[model samples]
Target: MDELVLDGNAAAGALAEIYGDDMTTVLAECASCGRVDPIGGLVAFVHAPGIVLRCTACATVMIRIVQTPSRTRIDVRAKRIPPPPETAR
Candidate 1:
């Protein structure tokens, strides 16, 4: 499992091409475990035909991306989490 898994940064190129922005800093909330983390912190499996991003806490599939000759398909199960409130000094 360790050999097959990779950090979410591996998908940064593909994600940037699709979203036209750097997605690594984006925060996502796992639907299954309610764990929030940046997209770069998720577990990534890119050896398959498509890229699969899973939650680090519960191993839940958060995002999947596949590219075809005609178009690119992406399924995102994780929703964005708002940044935490800033504290006053």
Candidate 2:
């Protein structure tokens, strides 16, 4: 709940740690399978500014990041569903 700029993947418990200055891990439980993904590997989509990120595991959309012309944080949130874990890959 630190409120750092993060991707939708980060919201799904896929990220292990905040891996960069631009991102943070937003931890939450999966609504579907109830598995803990730690928001790992897939957070790259969230952390990447202006670039859309998809789940590396399930190839489903995680979230979208919009950056200013200067590439600043615009908005962030979870979507309809979280992606499956990498094991699903």
Please tell me which predicted candidate would have the highest lDDT against the true structure: 1
lDDT of 1 by residue, 45-73 (tens): 99999999999999999988887787666
Q: After superposition, how far is residue 62 of candidate 2 from its true place, in Å?
A: 0.9
Off by over 4 Å in 1: 81-89
**RMSD (CA, Å), each prediction:** 8.5, 12.2
CA lDDT scores, all candidates in order: 0.82, 0.37
Worst 10 residues of 1 by lDDT: 80-89
Q: 1-89, model 2: which lDDT tens digit per residue?
A: 22443444443332222123323343433333333333334434443445444444444444444445443332223343334233322
Residue 41 of model 2: what lDDT? Answer: 40
Q: Please give the clash total of every predicted structure, in order.
A: 0, 10
Give me the runs in candidate 2 sitting further than 4 Å from their true place.
1-23, 28-36, 43-49, 70-89
Candidate 2, pairs of clashing residues = 7-46, 13-37, 13-38, 13-39, 14-38, 14-39, 14-40, 15-38, 15-39, 15-40
Model 1: C-alpha RMSD to truth?
8.5
